[model samples]
Target: MLKLRKLNAYYGTSHIIHDLDLDVRKGEIFCILGRNGVGKTTLLRSLLGIDTRTRGSIELDGVDISEAPTYKRAQFGIGYVPQGREIVPGLNVLENILLGCNARSDGRRDVPPLVWTLFPFLKEHLTRRGTNLSGGQQQQLAIARALATDPRVLVLDEPTEGIQPNVVADIEKAIVSLNRDHGLTVILVEQKIRFARTAAQRFVILEKGRVAAAGAAAELSNELVRKHMSL
Candidate 1:
């Protein structure tokens, strides 16, 4: 389980996350929702130790990791898939996935068989350049790469963004499969109401870097959520 308590983070001199708190249990999908620029991505970065948290504690299975560096935190089984699907364009699909292995070389990833089973297209396009794949395929590669690390907790920033509806469905299906099959903890950062509504059990809504509301999906009132979520 991953827990954040009163997390205070700053980007340069500007404080972005304000006393944010959240918890993600194992085998569950925890969704963070809000409009753009509400510091959703920043929160994920903070959890991954990309930014210096000014105060509070981030704990993974009761171990404090707020002060741990990014690489060290990664070594503790935290995998991140950033918003842009940052796969190396010049590298082949296999090589791109290999980048997830925390290795210093190419075609040398110890990728799990289940990962390729989840994303069979990756195996088929192993030699294709990362840039040549379609948007959905690239997204799949990014996710598959993250799984290569064999993380206990996977934090994804907007998995459904910039892809076709069919692809989004596929990604959602994959997330569900990951949780059900491996008990992988998933923290999903999303702006799409439909994605949160359908995929998450609990929801956390941020407005201007603060948690404006939080509750189980069934308890949330749709009309009010839509009001705060309007762009």
Candidate 2:
């Protein structure tokens, strides 16, 4: 339920994303795939209105949010789990997740039940400092924080990157469960081809700030991956 048309993004006149167009259908996992420096993160920043100037239209559920500020975008139901899991250092686990409640329109400040259900460990460690967590726990904390926003669409950048293998599987399972069970629409930027293939219903590969290839996940063949994503 997110659409981008003729979208271009820049960092102080250095254009990063060209006239990229994409549509993320409701309740599906849509992956953005590309090698490094191909504008995947830039596109996400553009969508979030974070540190980037963008042109063209970004429509969410048929309402044009192209000009909306970052907080407004979040209030409009887009939850962002940025790369590096930028959890607040001073905030405790519960406090960090509650930070997302600031974006909620409903005026509720408590953590969403879904967060507790998805991450039971968080409940036991609610008083622990967020940044003191392990890498995998920090990623889960980031995702939990986003979920607390009561989002319709969840956007994640490289959710599994740099995590241990076992924890990677947990995060992957959580992503899939978030979509399959909860009906949350997901827009994911990921480098892992296997997870993208398995978890995404559709995907786009970017090159030089534009879409190089896009289709149903089944159409993402070895040849296409080699041509566009292989190092």
Model 2 segments more than 4 A misplaced: none
| Candidate 1 structure, TM-score to reference | 0.94
Give me the displacement of residue 135 in model 1, in angstroms. Answer: 1.0
Candidate 2 lDDT over residue span 1-231, tens digit each = 899999999999799999988999999999999999999999998999999999999999899999999999999999999999999989999999999999999889998888888889899999999999989999999999999899999999999988988899999999999999989999999999899999999999999999999999999999999999888
Report the lDDT tens digits of candidate 1 across residue range 1-231.
888899988899888899888888777889988888888999999888885556799999999988888877777888899999998969998888877888212334587798788999889889999989888888999998888877888999998889988888889899988987778989999877776877788988888999998888775578757777876
lDDT values for all models: 0.85, 0.95
The reply for model 1, stretches above 4 Å from the true place, is 51-53, 103-108
How does residue 9 of candidate 2 score in lDDT?
98
Best model per lDDT:
2
- Pairs in clash, predicted candidate 2: none
